[model samples]
Each structure stands twice: as C-alpha cells, then as structure tokens.
Target: MDMEQSRQKRSFAPRALPHEEYFAPGHRGCQGCGPALAFRHILKALGPNTVVAEATGCGEIISSPYPQSSWRVPWIHTAFENTAATAAGIEVAYKVLMRKGRIPEERINVVAMAGDGGTGDIGLQALSGALERGHDFIYVCYDNEAYMNTGMQRSGLTPFGAFTTTSPAGKVSKGQSTWKKDVPAIAAAHHIPYVATACISYMSDLYRKILRAAEARGPAYLHVLAPCPTGWRYPSEKTIEIGRMAVRSGVFNLYEIVDGKKRLTVKVRERLPVSEYIKAQGRFRHLTDEDIAYIQRRVYEEYEALLAEAAQI
Candidate 1:
C-alpha cells in the first residue's frame, strides 16, 4: 500500500500506550533523539518489573549520569562490551534467587541495550556468547548507524557511502568503504527463539515486536534503526520522517524471525526511490549519481532477498 494508506491503517496499540511512565523525565537526550524515544517505549511495554542493563553509549549517557538517573525501573550501566554478559548474569541471579525463595517467585524481565558500536563492533563477542548460551533475556541494539555519541565515527553497522568523521567523502573514497554489518542475521545464526528488526517510526509494530520478544522463552534479539539528527545531518524534527523514508525506500526494513522462520512485519508495496531517502540527509550530500545508484542496487537486492526469505514461511 502507499504511505498514506499505511498510515491510515496503522493501529499503534489496541489501547493507547500505558499512561504510566517508567522512564522518568529530566534526561538530557538530544533534540529528537530516536534512541531516547525507543527507551521510553521499551520501558512502557516491559513495565516496572523489568530491569535494564545499558552499555556505555548514547543511551547510557543520555539517561544516566553520576548523580542523576532517568529510569524509574531498575537499571544498571555496564561497559561498552559487556552489557549482554551482565544482563545474562542478572537473569541467572534472579532465577537462583527465586528458586531459593530468597525473592518472591515472580517473573522479572531482563534487557540489555546498546548502540550500534557496542553491539556490532566492541561488544560482538560478549553478545554472541550470551545468545549462544541461551540466556533468558532480551538484547536490544538501538542502531543510529554510526557512533553518534562519540562524534560521528564510522562503525561496523554504518551504511555504505555514509559520511562520518572517519569515513569522509572525498577524492580517495566516497564514504564508508564497506556495507552495513548484518547483525540480525548474526544473532539469528545462534538459533535464538526470537529475532526482529524495528524502527522508531513505526511505533505500533515496534511495540508489538518488543512484547513478543519479551515473551520468548530463550534469548531474544531486536535490532532497532534509530535515526540520529546530529550524526545523520538531518534536522532534529525530521528524525521520524527520515526513518519512515528509510523504510519506504528499502534502506531499512521491518521483519521478524520466529523459531527459525522469517516473516515481513511491515511490507512496503510501493517503495519510493532511494534518492528520496538519501537526499533528505546531509550525510549523503556528496554522493554522486553513480554512488546513489550503487547504494540503491544493493538495497533492492537485499530487500528482494528478504522478501524471498519471508515467502518461504
């Protein structure tokens, strides 16, 4: 369906999002920070019984400082490379406590959150270990594409031809020389019970996926595409719009893998040209016609491949 039709048909929730807030106000997130919005929704869906283990990234810095915190639920800050490991430990500890009757026998959700750098680059080993070990928790990678908290450095998950402090578009190179890392596929390779891709632009789908992930028995992985206004060189107010464009142009997609089966959650029947998405951001300003075409070709190929994979289910 068309974008307007999709919008009209959207049902964000059977009811409105919870009136209660688990992520408190007074946090110092940037204007139109996608990750910050993501955190709010995450807590709202998981509720007060959830505990979050956040890595040292944008999400950590924005919500927690030495003397202050924005989280109403239990939250812990871990190193950039050990968020998942720490969350796994927490899950084990909670299980042990409940079994020993030291704590009430109640369900408590455990979640690990990190940025793209922490997930795909610095924290890959720890994350892989946790998933392979079958930890009963959720791992969330809020991908803004680059290391936005660290001055827009190129990261493993950064899209090809996207400009960053390290990957500048110049005479020698167009931008990042490599394609974005397929972290979701890497997570699914472990045969996790649930793996999903989401974007903040589609709140209904995102919320639904998070709830499903929380309900999964074993480990669950969610890769959320969070657009960065600062790092992506877009107007702060356009963060959600840029994200929507990314999905509609096939630059990003929404899908989920359940028990080794793949399915498309939000299908775009008529995708706009990739240029529509590219031109909205300054990061791709230096891209030439050839460069854009190359990027578009890759997007089309990957999206088509995703469709084929989902069709098998």
Candidate 2:
C-alpha cells in the first residue's frame, strides 16, 4: 500500500456497528446521500428505543413508501411546519406514561428530524416553542442548505451567493445575496440545555454530539451539515469530500454550545479559499470572480467571529 493509505489505515478507528437498524436500505435516496448516512449514525448513537418525528422533506419520503418503510424504529411523518410540535407531543406523552407507570421511563428517547427548509424556515416557530417550553427531546436539522426535495429551491439557510431554483443567477442578479441563518446560535439564545453544529464528514464527532444531545435533560438541538449531491450538482462520490471542504474552507464550523457557552470542537488545520469549496459543486458555477471573493471574505469573517465566541467561553 502507498504511504498515505498506510497512514489512513493506522489512524482509522472502526465504528461499532449497531445491531438495531433504524433505517433499512430498501428505500430510495440519491447515491452518496448525506442525510441517509446522518440517520444511520444518529440511530447508532440513539439505539432502538428511540422514536423519530420527521417533517415533510427528503428524509420523510425516502424512509416511508406505501406499505413498506425503511425506518426500523417507530417513526411519525408530520407536516413540513410541525416536526417540533409533533416531537413535543411525543415527549409529553412519554412523560405522562412514565408518571402513570404505564410505560418505562427509560424505554424511549424522542427525536425530531428535518431538513434545512423545514427546520430553519417552516418549522422554526414550532422548534422555538418546544425549546422555550423545555421539552425533553432532541431536535436535529440535517441541513443540506436548501429545499433539496423540492427541486433545490432557496431556503433561509442557503448560503450567500449560492444559486438555487428560487434564487437563480442571471444578468440582473447574482444568486442568493443574503447570509445563511445561524440556527444553532438561535437555539442557544433560547437558553436550552444544549445546542451544537456538526457535519457528517466527522462521523465520530457527529455520533458523540447526537449521544450527548439525547442524554441531555432538556431540549437540545443539533444542526448537522448534510451535503446533497443532487441538489449541489456534484458527483455522487464527492459527497463526503465536499462536506469536508466546506468545513476546511470555513464555510461551516463544527462547534457546540453547552449551557450558553460556545466551544469550538474541530479547528481547520489548513484553510482553503471559499471558491475551492464552491467550485466543486455546480450550484455555484454561475458565480463570478467578484462573487467568489465576496463569499471568501464572508467565510473568513464568520470563522473569526466564531473564534471570538469560543474565546469568550
């Protein structure tokens, strides 16, 4: 084997495969779908007694089909705007059942999962309500940055200057001009027990975050950067690589907010230009040199701000 391959083999830590599969393989998702992988890792950490409340998006459709379903756990598909509400209800039900000795308190963990559009936009209010109410559950946003299931449309979480169906680049416009919403920061503002941002590229870190979130006493939110190959217009095999590039370019930082304190979990060893990350995906193909420069500036500024926040902690 080559030196690089030898080094990789030495550094690799095999993950303990979970015997209970929450998501079966029969359902359809695009090749190299990050959300599918995210679910698998999440289930590995959460185990079999967990119940999932999924919103209307790629996750729901891909896991449920007529008489057949991919989810091995108890799953509920709710409206696009009500994932948090549904999860809150399930949590309340679990508490009541446990109190009445109708169900074992340790038997289940409730989790709410949604895509960026569903969590960052449509379900934001419900999520905020659940957190403010101190619901005992975990809310996970598998963010691919846009509404991937709905034809790659722009959502509030779509990054600045990225092209989507709703924010197409043209002679008069230059893709999405606004910045991506800081959903984890917003969740932190709610003063919940825990909030963290993770990416699928770091499987071990992501798994640990999910496990922590599940064990927390009150409401917890995990915002995961799950790449969508089809939506980003990238080759299926490049999904993990693209996700890694996003973090290394400062476009996405992996961090955790515990009890209102910010902490940086993964630091980029060698930062690359934002254009290098954008160029890998066809969604940003229409961007001009000026646009790429603007994005790079914004990414650096955001990374610096995160560093400052971490410093304050």
**What are the lDDT scores of the predictions, listed in order?**
0.91, 0.88
- Please write out the lDDT profile of model 1 over residues 85-143, one tens digit for every residue: 99999999999999999999997899999999999999999999999999999999999
Candidate 1 structure, TM-score to reference: 0.95
CA shift of 273, model 1, Å:
0.6
Report the Cα lDDT for candidate 1: 0.91
What does candidate 2's lDDT look like per residue over 200-227, in tens digits?
9998678668767876889999999999
RMSD of each: 4.4, 5.0
Candidate 1 segments whose C-alpha is farther than 4 A from its true place: 1-14
Per model, how many backbone clashes are there? 0, 0
Q: Which ten residues in a row have the lowest lDDT in candidate 2?
A: 3-12
TM-score of each: 0.95, 0.94
CA RMSD (A), model 2: 5.0
